[model samples]
Target: MSAFSLSQALAWIKAAAQSIDANAAHLSELDAAIGDGDHGANMARGMAAVTKKIDSAPPADLAALFKSVGMTLLSSVGGASGPLYGGFFLELGKQSAGKTELDAAGLAAVLGAGLGDIRRRGKAEPGDKTMVDALIPAIDALAAASDLAQGTAKAAETARAAATATAPMLARKGRASYLGERSIGHQDPGANSVALLFAALAQACA
Candidate 1:
């Protein structure tokens, strides 16, 4: 019964924004090895905007809250991540419509839907060494958990591990894909951000 509420989601997003902000430099460094070097800055800006809006007046419903974050990120963040990540949240909102709290199964269903949308929009998959690699496992872990808290924590851990796991994977999507085997040893920026999202949600659930 410890399902995450809109307020909790909002709080988690804000905390995630700050965490992203703190890690912006490191993220940028990571991206510099395989990306445009702006992933960190772009995500930081988008999350900061999301945090500001939520701080002003958080949404009460899941749809409204995620819509707000998605719209804000779409408007603020630049590059491929803006629309991709923003759309991910928007899709999750659509899946969670009318629900204030989601049990493990409910959370899993919504997350699966969200990942499907992201894959459709980004044209990536698990072995692509993109965020999907981390997100897919995290969602699976959440789905297998018995409760929201355990699910969130499992997702967070899975995301973190998957992000690190991506370092050895061959790139199959995004700009990194262009590097082929050369992309090895560098973590995908999107996976790192997804990890942050899961970590934030886990903290909020706590």
Candidate 2:
């Protein structure tokens, strides 16, 4: 796809919800190793709320859609994931305001804005073993792509790899930081969820 529309955005949200639901248990298990074990359930609940919001009162525009998703996640999810993920989507909405469709450059701007928001909100760096590790690489990959589909696909792949690479890193932020050296061998739950988000975006663009 050359451009991303409202329908495609909705599809991406739906796909994210489904992917979260399917991996909820695994996510929780991953979190149990280093952080709170509620990441999966919290994310699943938030995505369900987003789905309900979409089904009950469909957004009239891309901005509305992203805002609705962001707000719903903010209110429904638990733990730090609620605020961090919620802020990401809210910033995406803000960057995409007044736009009906996004081309490659527009999508890159939206993702970059979201990543910046996450960085500001969380104050975490790439090697902090947080979601930033996945998201930053994904943003870089998306920015380098030539088209929407290719960009999203590359982003998803890069995000997944980045998330996986976080396994050996020590946590410097969030609940995992409490573990210090103990957090080194475990994968970061937040990074996993970030990877899932990009994976869903890739599928939607495909």
| Top candidate by TM-score | 2
Model 2's lDDT to the true fold?
Answer: 0.93
lDDT of 1 at 97: 88
Worst 10 residues of 1 by lDDT: 1-10
**Model 2 agreement with the true structure over 1-206: per-residue lDDT tens digits:** 99999988999999999999999999999999999799999999999999998999999989999999989999999689999899989998998899999987789889899989989999998799999999888988998888999999999999999999999999999989999999998999999999999999999999
Whole-model lDDT, candidate 1?
A: 0.87
- The per-model lDDT (C-alpha) reads 0.87, 0.93
Q: Which residue pairs collide, candidate 1? A: none
Q: What is the TM-score (0 to 1) of candidate 2?
A: 0.98
lDDT of 2 at 127: 98
The digit string of per-residue lDDT tens for model 1 on 1-206 reads: 46777767776787799899999988888888997788999999899899888778768798888888888999999788988888988988898888888777887898788888888999986788888999999999998998888888989999999999999988888788888889998998889988998998888887
List ranges where model 1 is wrong by over 4 Å: none
Model 2 root mean square deviation, Cα atoms: 0.7
